[model samples]
Target: MPYDYKPYAYHRPPGLTAPEPRHKVAIVGAGPIGLAMALELAQHGVPSVIVDDNDVVSVGSRAICWSKRSLEILDRIGIGARCVEKGVTWKVGRTWHRDREVFTFDLLPEDGHKMPAFVNLQQYYVEEYLIEAAQANALIDLRFRNRVKAVEQAADHAVAVIETPDGDYRLEADWLIACDGARSPVRAMLGLDFDGELFEERFLIADIEMAADFPSERWFWFEPTFHPGQSALLHKQPDNIYRIDLQLGWNTDPEEERKPERVIPRIEKVVGHRDFRLDWVSVYTFQCRRLRNFVQGRVIFVGDSAHVVSPFGARGGNGGLGDVDALGWRLAGVVRGEAPEAALAAFDRERQFGADENILNSARSTRFMSPEDGVERLFRDAVLHLANRVDFARPMVNSGRLSRPCVYPLVAPDATGLPEVSRPGAVAPDAPLADGWLLERLGVGFTVLAIGCAAPEVPGARALALPVTPELAARYLGGAGAAVYLIRPDQVVAARWTACGVEEIAAALTASREGRT
Candidate 1:
């Protein structure tokens, strides 16, 4: 059966009758990114108003792969465990050429982390979980059918003219985060545009319901006999539904191909049976693009509003989550006056760096998938052919490069001889702490995890001391003696040092809060 779609009820806005107080933060979309931002701000004691034109979760099964880093971010916002429980976890991905198997890779080669490498949950489910989380939080004021018609950003704040069933009204906020997806109204009102390449290839993506016991693994085929001279990808999702993506060259009419008459036969050839029911179908051409800058005055952009990439790399939503992970804390701190507003420039720089990385990876995989017929096809085929026989050539296979958390380039203080896993700029890795996970103990605040020393008395930061258990010692300590590690509110490692006294800890915290190197 096709997944049932339900819309949430909309009510009259409180501001319809009279003016309301300006919000500290206003988010302009109720998608996963915007809701997560609101919840994140709420966690930091910052309340926000979330306005959206739509009143439901996603209608399509778009963006099915959630990365581990995204899961970690979700964990902080209170939906991580629920998402994991409902999602189909998979780490092994296999690639094939024609009839021969070529390469296979395991994304999660290690353990001790709270989340898996990837989880196959539909975008709608994720949004549902996020909405539930936001609704449960008292700080988030969700307004459905409240469409943002115009936006004006000033030196100190932004004002959005929103239209609702009742009437139009002005919504003022110290900062406005746009999560309005690929076609962002905020971006248009500000007269800004994305800069990057738009690919010429088209693809047919479908969700089919079947009881087949296909293992939970990503299977990609290049020039398979069932779909000769093109690429096909299959992923198992929850509820016995599978997502299949097939390449359709530039000449193919998307409308004609989307018809059930055309789609069912193509799927039948691949599955070798007519026992499946089609749930949803979409034809799309992807782009790898991003804004010139994510932070523009008092208006900020997150998720698809900030950048977009091809599905092959799973970078689309995952990249947006990265924006959420990086922006939430900085914006929260600035709103509360705990940090200078100049720190937003650092968020702009680091997230752009991450966007560039996603674009580069997605573009390369796309080129490999839809290579030109002459030398490009020859070289691609040669690589795929050689991959079957040699280990060295296997890495050349370009199934969508899976999404991973990007480590920003930060010049914060660091202690030499420490393990590189928990380096500055990277997310503080998850580990076991007695009966619970290490992250739960750290909480959502600036933290100093002191090992081999007494906990420091740093103002405005939480301090936790840990004895060197074998696992903690290996992952965090690594025989580097007693060290003090500073963690950001977003749980990123700000700095670490063996002899980081209170003065140095305060300096690292200052640099981190100020967004300086």
Candidate 2:
């Protein structure tokens, strides 16, 4: 079965003939991160121009797993539901050794949350949904077939030379965001380099469509009989498509391994027959690396351009979305003149912290999966052998840590009574409200979520008061009395206090904007 990769119509830009005024923000790349970043900005009433080299969504099922935190960000832009509806929802993951089950884990144990633990949706589908939703937002000006050849950053603005089908054009933007993926031209143009580890191991990744009744759970095998000594992972996706990854040692030639002849046999071994059709196949090596800083003067890097991680943990895409969430409020505030230029420093500081966390986890997973000979391999094998027998050893097995939201450390006001889930510096947890979910009630702006009490009116923030329900009490109030929470536009808790006044709340808001807190 082949995917219908439709091409988007590219409108001839006026920049080719005449000089246009400077745009507030110019985004490079139209993948998930760039599109999401553009949409997030538009939600904050900021217009952006997105320029990409290609018109079609990704050809392969590149990033298939969308974390709950990513879904929450997508929900903010009104595409979360659509993604879930078209995605395969799964929570359970099992690990096996030589056809024998060793460990099983549930991603989400409790209920009541609207989103599942994770959804397996192809990259193209997610991009198509984002592109469709973006078209409705007039603030988003998408230009396809426009590839950036060179970029120069001035003191206050950035200039890019885009080579379009018609001709080359010069576009200037106040802030140029490079979401241009792993091999970013913008980063290369700036002569910046990523500082981290690149694993020598390679894995053959493939998407197969089959009509099988496999349970919607992640199945991983360590030293599977079919692929002896190597690891294997299976995940279910929408439209009867299943994603399979087989560990091909670093010695194997990727070009030879990706051939359909070689790939077909691997699929047959995993599925037990030649009943499945290969939808997509590729070979990739893992790397856990990121830039020293996300921001560089008038130019900023987001998504893969800023950081990259192994696919094992699903951190690459989700971590990029974290960059979007952290950047949206601060960049919007800076562009809108509501916050100082120093606010972008917050985006750099917080997202850098996130990149570090992702790198640490991903690096560990990579090492566990691809250990060297001697003590490393010995310990890895021991953990797998003992994992089936003991509970403590099970935790040592690192198939993939899976993506989770990184909690940024905050120095804002707080109290001990509130639950740690909604503590300052964490994304505000979701609970069912009367009209909608707690996340739905907190609109795109600076908000004060007051539980069990009236919210204090801050100078430039919205105050949302809610009656303490059981779920709300459990998530937000804990054992404490009425409290106020200062939430940023991205639904991140900036600060919270059990007895916060207007002055304190206002100061916290300032700190959040300045990236100080």
Candidate 3:
């Protein structure tokens, strides 16, 4: 069944009648990224006002794949379990060349983590969950139908001119996060544009309601017999909806392709049946682009406003959550006067690194999927042909790299022989403890995870000591008998040591807070 979209009620703003107090943060665009940004800030006791031009959730099953890292981030903000329960969880991906199976990969072969490797929940569901959480939080003031028309940044604050149903009003905030999407009006107001590659290839995305007994695994085909000479992808979502992406060449007319007359036959060819209801259809060109810098004075860009990638890798939405993860705690610290404004530079630095990584992968996948008729095509066909029987060539198949958390390149404390999974600059690996999960105990703050040893007291950081279980030992301790780790508020490892003193742990914590790491 198609989702019923309900409009959120909008009320008159106090700023329409009188000047309002400055907000700690003002986020434009109430999409998944913007709403999640508000909720994440609220979790740190920082209030934010979210404004958007629309009142309803997204119309289609956009951004259906949520990575494990994104799930963990959502869990911290209080919606991970709901997303997991409602989403179609899958980890295995199969890639085929013509009628032959070429490559198969498992994203998560180990256990003990709280979230699955990936979940196929629609973007609208995620937005709805975040909106509900936002409405219940006192720190989040959601202003639906309030559109940001113009933005101006001062030395200490940013101001947005918003047009609402009642009247036009000015909103002031210490920081303005433009969670507004790919065609961000806020970014346009600031006269900034993305710089990267835009491929000539086009793809058709159709969400169809079907009652099929397909496994919840990602299936991709290269020049399949059904959709001859073109690539296709299939993913299962909740509500018996299936997401189908059929690669259409650059010459195909988007308007003509989107019509039901043109879409149904193509979908019928892939599914081998005409018994499907097309729910939503969209045609998009491939793009891998980003802003040179995500932060511009007091107005910062988050999500699609900062970067965009081809949809193949599931990087667009997941990368946005990465921005929220990196920025939320730092922005909260700055708002509460706990950290200097310079701390935001780290958010800008790390997320740019992440965006570049995503763009690189997305671009590579696009090139392979829609190769030109020369060397690119020759190489792609050769790889697919060789992959059918050879183990070495199977790794060369470029269906889509899939999304994973990018480890920030931070120069921090480190120790040899400890597990690389929990090394500095990486997200702390999750493991099972006696009572619950390791991430749940991390508690959205700096943590000293001492395994197989007593935890050292560090100011402004929680200490957790545990006898090493098999999973913990494998993920955190490696071959070492004991290990100590300094975890950042975002659950990223700031430092780790086979053994460390209290003073060293305290210094690492201070450095991480100050963005020195």
Candidate 4:
């Protein structure tokens, strides 16, 4: 089948064209976030150029876990199936104390979704898969082994001066994105302050090929038998590869702890066997940090560039992935002329919320895993034990605690007069359709969903009516409430009314097209 490549509704100015002008967006890092953003733009028929300093695709597996929300975003970009094939699905996790299971939770059953609880795939593999998916589109161009020497941002465009192996060149992009990791040069060039704390303790992440009798489940040994001061986490990866995280005692030397041979012997003491062959071992001291702002001027930071979460709950990579998914659709709108330049402000507000929330949750999880003092550890254990005892307690702990789903309150509204619909930031719920697709499937475009009512006259945009049945009514809107909801291209609830009148609908659609309320 021939590919469908639709041009953006708005075109670049014709008079100001360079001989080698290629794409509209310039992505600074070729990591997962940058790759995902490029693929997202490709789906919208908007071209982008991904520039990176690495000569080849990243090899080391810096990230090892994926959450449910990340999986859904991959599916939206049409690469979820390939990712599932390469990753190992994890549904249950065991919290071990003194080599005995204390708490075991089934993550998949908790969500009540068809998707798995989490997947353990090497970060490099995920990057490779996305890069391959990007090849199908003419919009994504990968420029590797090129260091960006300078980036000068103007109101309309960003000029990146890159130092390639051959020579120096200047590249211009309408908008620029920074997905570079923790030591972000782009952020430094912009003179942004990354304000946060760094934990003094270090940990060793060792990848090994071992024959073990342990069950294939995620295990976190909080209070372990062999180590009194340190905790251990054993996560199984693909091809009999296992990632073992051994927390270094508070005073262990970094140089001595990172040496593979030295790290292996310490791991052997805990496992009671020295049979496993170690593949790679690296010692890392993680920090709990967050950027002051996710967006500065026209340059936006995603993933590690935005925040650095300790590897306690595996939130660093997952949090970054969420940032790209949240920002991609909105940025696409600005590029396509469906939204205004001010729409970018909402990206800053929403991602800042996500970044702050993830940072706090990860900090709490880290504290629980490795409590600072006696009083803190006691409170942590008591909370978990209490949760196990009471039903209501479990819900309290699970309230936006374990990454169920994120609902944003509108900081910037796209419509007016509908107080219920104009709430600051709300993600439209995923409504399953009769045809087996989802309401999210309609997200690739500007969608106006008028539930149970005639297509209310949205003067400037496309509106899709969600047939309001008794079942649909009970699920989405209350019986007394308006069955019709206007959904924006970004899958945000725009304007909802009890009745989708022509005037109300038109006003909502016009505001969204104009990109503000």
Candidate 5:
């Protein structure tokens, strides 16, 4: 018998109408954000269809690093442990000027933080895990080789025209989300402009397998001598694989290519005469652009479709994953009939705020990566030297503003006039439980914290009180006298108070659950 090597696109049988008149969310592009949104919806028992044009998982390593915040989201969906197994934790990194080492700072030792630093993992691993989990989820329909040909939004529902191997079909959904890449068709379909400054420098990211004397630690070389305009960054992944990013100066040919010999020369310049085999190499330009708006009618933009920043600060992937975490829970609520359509609007206000902050951080990182001129480089070097001498100047050397998650002010009023414990804008901080459990353990669903009182007698909420264990309490609650914090399903703070009162607690719950003041 002859072998049949036929290529055909894949598609789901057909989407059933939502059980009730629920908000149906149709996600385009089954990349990280799309898969993450599917997992989030599945956890909440909401129905969703995840469609993508690419039939197979990605081959290249696009996002090789995850921030402290991204890992927490994975934990909630029950993949955090698996992710930890495949990923390596980096607590410290060194900044360099040519061969000279500058000041080193600890990223994990900050006050009230659970994890020390970021985790370096292959982007494909994240997608692999999410895909596996989504396949097991009965509520989520994962459709591969299915592309969104067109999107039409109506007052009642948004319709997506899907192009599969079989043919094109129309899918009517209550909402359409775009997790597509930089050149987003959905964004173009809606006639939205991605407005921001663009960087002209070209860069090459190469992953290599090596067995040599290279440093196993993370290092960033600032303005190396071998290439006057080039800077090199080395990150170690699982197995003897390392991700090497080489800045290939400004004003290069668009068709300028990178040969293995050219890449090996740069690698040898940094890691003294070490033998290594290159695995994959890709060259691309960088940009710092974001869409003018995130939400248009029933459709919303997310991931690279919404914003594209220079990879200097590692904000490109991190920012998009943050969008998945933020929008997932709210979309789940709307689909589950727990919230109104108005709740979808908050996705715009919140995600746009995050996008704005991260892009600015990317711009700052770019400034440090490629300084304007010799004068700027001299000024930066002097500042670093001064940082070494002064105690307080260390933070100035390391931009504190860049490391932390951007906090958006709560627009609606909660039980307390002050911000709720894990309000929408705030990054969810860890808390303690009387049972010696970390607050993150309760992240699978919405958590309510009641302090200085008995656990609330609510049907859906689980509460904790003050005067916890000496060890566990100190580890999380930030000391015994601190107030209680109610965490949302998305791992964001919901509400907090010095003492728990039924009325105040109820108000906090109402605002988060109903999206109203």
Candidate 6:
């Protein structure tokens, strides 16, 4: 079934007639990142106003793969379960060289976590679900068709001149988040440009509605006979939709290649049949680029406005969600006057680290997938040839190193014998508890997780003490009898100790809250 492109109703804002009160935060995009930013802020008791030029969701099935970390962040904002139920879930991926299989990987071999490895849902459906959730939240004021025309930054606040259907209006806010996407006008208003590499390669993305018996696993072929000297990718989405990506050299014209006449025969060769209806077709050339600094004065950038990667790793959307997760609580604190404005520096620093990590990985994958003529091509071909015979070479296969949350480098308290998965600056690993789950207990605030020990009393922090289950012991208390973990508001482990006093825990909590960790 085709998705309904229902437009959101736009009403005249109060600023059209007269000046309105300053908002705590003003978001200038209604895409996934902007909508999720509003919801995440609302979760922290901060109100935000979201404006976008478009009233409808994305036109095509863009950004179909959602990572597990992204789903966890979405669950916090209230749409993860719906996306999981509606999307096709898969954890395994197979990489092939021509007709022979070279390597396969299971992203999530264990079953303790709540979200799966990856969910293949169209960008439109996720936006619809987020829009519904944002509408229900009283703290989020969503204004559709309100495009940002001009932006002015002051010493303490930023103002956006919004052009609406009725008239132009000026909206002021203490912070302006630019989630307007890859070609961000806000970034241009601030005279900022991305600094990175743009690969000279193009790929045809076609979403075809077809009924088939293919398994729900990612399939990537290198130099396949069907495509002939090019790479191809296949994935199954909901509503009998299958996404196909065929690599086209830099010389091919995008406009001519996107035509159905040019796309249908290529897809037919890959699928070996003509029983498919083309849902959406697009030809894209991607780059792994990002801004040097995500924060500039009172204005901040999130999502693609801050960074953009190739479509292969599913990093673009997921990395944007990572920015939302990292910024929401800190920005809320700064707005509420609970924390100094300097705390935002940490958000800027950490997310910059994340964006660099994403760009590095994406660039490497792009080089591997579309290598140059000489030594680069030789390396890729050698790895692929040896991958099938040698176990050591199997890990060299790089079919877009699937997106995973980047562990921020934090200088904080830590102990040696604990598991690396729950180390400082890394997200806390989920474990099954006696009742629900570990992450469920670690709400949207600072949490003191004491495993196999009593939690110490810390002001302004929730403490949870639990007996050691096998999963908890293995993940949190490796070789140690008891451990205490100080978790930040975003669920990243701030500090950990085998045994800690109340004063140590208190000091750690203060550091984490102040973004010192």
Top lDDT hit:
6
Candidate 1 lDDT, 239-289, residue by residue in tens: 888999999988899999999999999998777785899999999997899
Q: Which of candidates 1 and 4 is the stronger one according to lDDT?
A: 1
The regions of model 3 sitting more than 4 angstroms off are: none
Model 1 CA deviation exceeding 4 Å by range: none
lDDT of 6 by residue, 357-387 (tens): 9999999999999998899999999999999
| Predicted candidate 2 versus true structure: per-residue lDDT over 278-335, tens digit per residue | 8899999999888998999999999999999989988988999999999987899899
Itemize residue pairs with steric clashes in candidate 6: none
Ranking by lDDT: 6, 3, 2, 1, 5, 4
Per-residue alpha-carbon lDDT of model 5 for 72-177, expressed as tens digits? 7777776776777778777677766666676576667644545536888887778878888888888887788888888888887888777877767778788888
lDDT of 6: 0.94
* Ranking, TM-score, top scorer first: 6, 3, 2, 1, 5, 4
Poorest 10 consecutive residues of model 1 by lDDT? 466-475
lDDT of 3 by residue, 356-435 (tens): 99999999999999888999999999999898788999888989899999988889889898877887889998887778
Relative to the true structure, candidate 3 reaches a TM of 0.99
Candidate 6 at 120: error in angstroms? 0.8
TM-score (all chains, Cα) for each model = 0.97, 0.98, 0.99, 0.84, 0.88, 0.99
lDDT of 4 by residue, 156-265 (tens): 78888877656677788888899989888998888886787776777888888776666667777755777665678888887667888888856878888778768777
Model 4: how far residue 434 lies from native, Å: 4.2
Among all windows of 10 consecutive residues in model 3, the one with the lowest summed lDDT is 508-517
Clashing pairs in 4: 408-425, 409-424, 409-425, 410-424, 410-425, 411-424, 451-484, 482-498
Shift in Å, residue 272, candidate 2:
0.4
What's the distance in Å from true for residue 82, model 4?
Answer: 0.8
Residue 58's lDDT in candidate 3: 95
